[model samples]
Target: MTHDPIPARLAALKTTSTPDLKSQWRDLFDTEAPPFNRRYLESRLAYRIQELVYGGLKPETVRRLERLGEELDGGDKRKRGIRADRDRPITGTRLLREWQGVEQIVTVTRDGFEWQGRPYKSLSAIARAITGTRWNGWVFFGLKNHRGRA
Candidate 1:
């Protein structure tokens, strides 16, 4: 049997007071390229309405959405405010220069060398062994005396 056209079925569905009809419409749009393109175009019209109704999102929320989009599109996954170059020891020196805390020191036992007042055998070993998500400030700063002299 031939199926009823989507526009007619959608019109019929609209007469009902079901909240889920929006989602059903979305699903139908996903299945049909023409409907999908139409809905995509129509959604742009609602952008201003959404902004007006929601009173616009906060700056932080907008940033989060941008970041999420980047991640979804296989772009950068790094968090904002985190400098990409700062992940390396050489670049992290700036952070070390700014902070005056002994806690910045991370001890390395393999190389038997002190880094930022903590001991470490080699940078590679430190990189390999310290598998945490946090930034390492010690390696970049180099060893400093208790007086804070590098």
Candidate 2:
């Protein structure tokens, strides 16, 4: 019968030193080791070893995961690493408000809000620019009631 070296190699990872693990990480992943803890190294090493023998995740699985991540963070790579707040409207949603007989329209974007071809980090800034006074953007935009109800 043909011999399998994967089990022995995987078992050896448990007793491997930190330095050796880092070296192995470099060799297997073809890059520098991350600044993570020992457990992270061991787990990643174990995964890498198995990946080398059994292959990696299927392409469809990877695509599905990426699609899910995009839905969570609106496909913003900077926000991809962190959990984003869900209170904001989805991208491309238009927020409309009328002030002093003029209609103001703001479009929600992945990064922030857009009003009159200008990008704003917060609704408050847009409200200030429109009124030259401090106002809660959510309240001014009618997104939240003065009593804090949505």
Candidate 3:
């Protein structure tokens, strides 16, 4: 009968402690271990062991997964090939619009927008304050269209 090493290795993982897990991480990854907690090491090592036994993902597949993750997480402004928003104003950008014969400006923040030295929950909130009515913030500032085109 053929032998299975996976169960034994997983059992050993449960028996081993945190310090030993770091050793395992180095043995498996062959690099200086990250300062991650025990559970992280255990899970990652389990995946690695299985990957070694069967096969690992293709390099191109891994790159695609990483790019998808970066797109979902709003990383790297110039990674538009990853489908990052093409025309969205960057964080810390200043947007200006004229309403009622007055020029108003808002500054972009990582989480939200700011206007008149005050942090706002959304651009729509700022638009409501400015126009005294409901307005699509992106349309008001021409960042995107009322129909959601840039």
Top lDDT prediction, candidate number: 2
What candidate 3 gets wrong by more than 4 Å, as runs, is 1-87
TM-score of each: 0.22, 0.52, 0.46
Q: For candidate 2, report its TM-score.
A: 0.52
Q: If the candidates were sorted by their lDDT against the true structure, best first, what order would they fall in?
A: 2, 3, 1
**Candidate 2 local Cα displacement, residue 97, angstroms:** 46
Worst 10 residues of 3 by lDDT: 77-86
Q: Which stretches of candidate 2 lie over 4 Å from their true place?
A: 83-150
RMSD in Å for all candidates: 17.3, 11.3, 12.8
> Residues 15-77, candidate 1, lDDT per residue (tens digit)?
543334445444534532233334443443244334544567899999999888787656755
State candidate 3's TM-score. 0.46
Query: Which tens-of-lDDT digit does each residue in 26-140 have in candidate 2?
Result: 9999999999889999999999999988999999999999999899879889987665566789899999999999999999999999999999999999999999999999999
Ten contiguous residues with the weakest lDDT in model 1: 91-100
Q: Which window of 10 residues has the lowest lDDT sum in candidate 2?
A: 79-88
Task: In candidate 3, list every pair of residues with a backbone clash.
Answer: none
What does candidate 3's lDDT look like per residue over 62-120, in tens digits? 99998897877687656545654557678989999999999999999977889999998
